[model samples]
Target: MNVLKCFNKGQPLPLRIKAADALRYLCSYDPVSQDIRTKITVIMAELLVLSNDNEFDLINEIMDDFVLKYAKELEPFALQLAKNLNIQFLRIAEELMNFSTTQNNDDKVSKEQLDKEYQASSILTNMNTMIITMTSEKDLTYALLGSVEPSIRFVLENCMANFISELMEILESFNYTMKCIVPEAWSIFDLVCESFDNFGFDYVLDYLQYFESIITYSFLEDGNKAGSNNDINAGQKTEEQKTSIKNEESKIISLVVKLLNEDNGENFADEDLVLFLFKLISLLVLKLGCVNF
Candidate 1:
């Protein structure tokens, strides 16, 4: 309990960080009771809210260790951690946007400006690390996904195109089984489709590539396994799962139709992208059944 007091607002950052490190070590090595570990986890989550940008990396290390060692204990705090993370992402997005405007106006970039850019980028890197770490745990995956959905939408809507790949990478981190089990899995795709107008054709194509991979893995591979197996109902999906996947497929097709109808193909005038779209449609038809749009 004394160690937890070091995280008081009056405490220095280094001291707080040291206290966090010490607690992490004790949680991992000491024969602590479940209640003590749960208390420590709650304290650590609160510390994240109080942490500044400079301390993100150190705090993330401690949080990651806590997640690894005490995932079940940390499950109750998933939503809290996710909300804190989204706040960080938004703060960094604003910083990156301001830095971009400053860079655009300045003819010669100063060392100070470069350092600011690097610091902003590092904060994002650490946030991504935390996201991947948290989402890898099955119990926390859906809760985190649902909590961070707004952040996902905000990033896509706001002109953060460069960071879209990072979002896609995070989505890709979920395995096939989780996708089938988690009803909120399709929320990301729904948000992407909603934000299509904000993206350029190149980014659209990047998103399409990701969609194709997901469709192939979730539908095609599973279909093949079912086809070869004697017991078709061995791993059958529940009716609710079937409905959820169907809704997802419809959303994807709707997005494709919207893309095709844009400017009567003028927007997709690039032959290569057009071909890729057709190929994706064909894949969908083959694996997921007829593509209406």
Candidate 2:
């Protein structure tokens, strides 16, 4: 209890670190009670929320090892932990953005700035690792997705282009591993479409290609060519699956048409993008037989 109390924001950093070390050591014992493990996980989550860049490495170690090591015992707190991590990620992202702006204004970088950048990078990597690890657990993934949608949108809309691209890659890996599509997944596509102007053509094209791949994976069957599996096998899709595919196809088509209609020859004028969209719409039409368009 005293060690847990030392995680409070009012505690000195060195004292908190030592206390965290002690807590981690104690939690690792074979004789520790399940109740004590749960309490330790709770305290760790709270400490993460209070942690800053100075505590990045320790927090990363706890997240990467300690959290996962006790994941089963701590399953009940998955959503709470995800929310806390998201809050911490937002804080770190803001720091990174500030560092980016600072770097842009200065002709030469300093040691302090480089150190800060490295710390921010480490935090970002740690958060990514934690996210991927959480997603590997079915219950944890469900809990994580419930709270992570806003963070996804924020990263997509506000972060630097490189970070936005990295986020898309992470989401792609998420989709590939999860296999089933969730509503939150579609929000990523929607945000990409809505923010078309902010991202470059290459990024937009990559997203479209990703969307196309998702369509193929979700809607088509093996041995049949893409868009040629009109008479899908009865075993291939459940009623719910069919409904989901139909809705997502409609949504994608609508987004494409809206982009085309609203384009005043400024954005969406890239020949490659236009050609790709044309091909994608054609594929969707072939699969659906008739889209209301």
Tens digits of lDDT, candidate 2, 114-157:
55444444444544554566554554564566566666777667
Worst 10 residues of 1 by lDDT: 224-233
What are the clashing pairs of model 1?
Answer: none
Per residue, candidate 1 scores C-alpha lDDT tens digits across 45-138 of 5667645446355666666566666656665666776677667766666766676776655545555455444443443444444445654455
Q: After the best TM-score superposition of candidate 2, give how far the Cα of residue 207 lies from its true spot, in angstroms.
A: 8.6
TM-score of each: 0.57, 0.55
Q: Candidate 2: misplaced stretches above 4 Å?
A: 1-12, 15-39, 49-57, 99-140, 162-169, 190-217, 220-293
Number of clashes in model 2? Answer: 0
The best candidate by TM-score is 1
Output the lDDT of residue 228, model 2: 32
Error of 2 at 132 (Å): 4.3
Off by over 4 Å in 1: 1-9, 18-39, 52-56, 102-140, 174-177, 181-187, 190-213, 216-293
What's model 1's overall lDDT? Answer: 0.60
Angstrom error of the Cα, residue 71, model 2: value is 1.4
Q: What's model 1's lDDT at 20? A: 80
Error of 2 at 167 (Å): 2.5
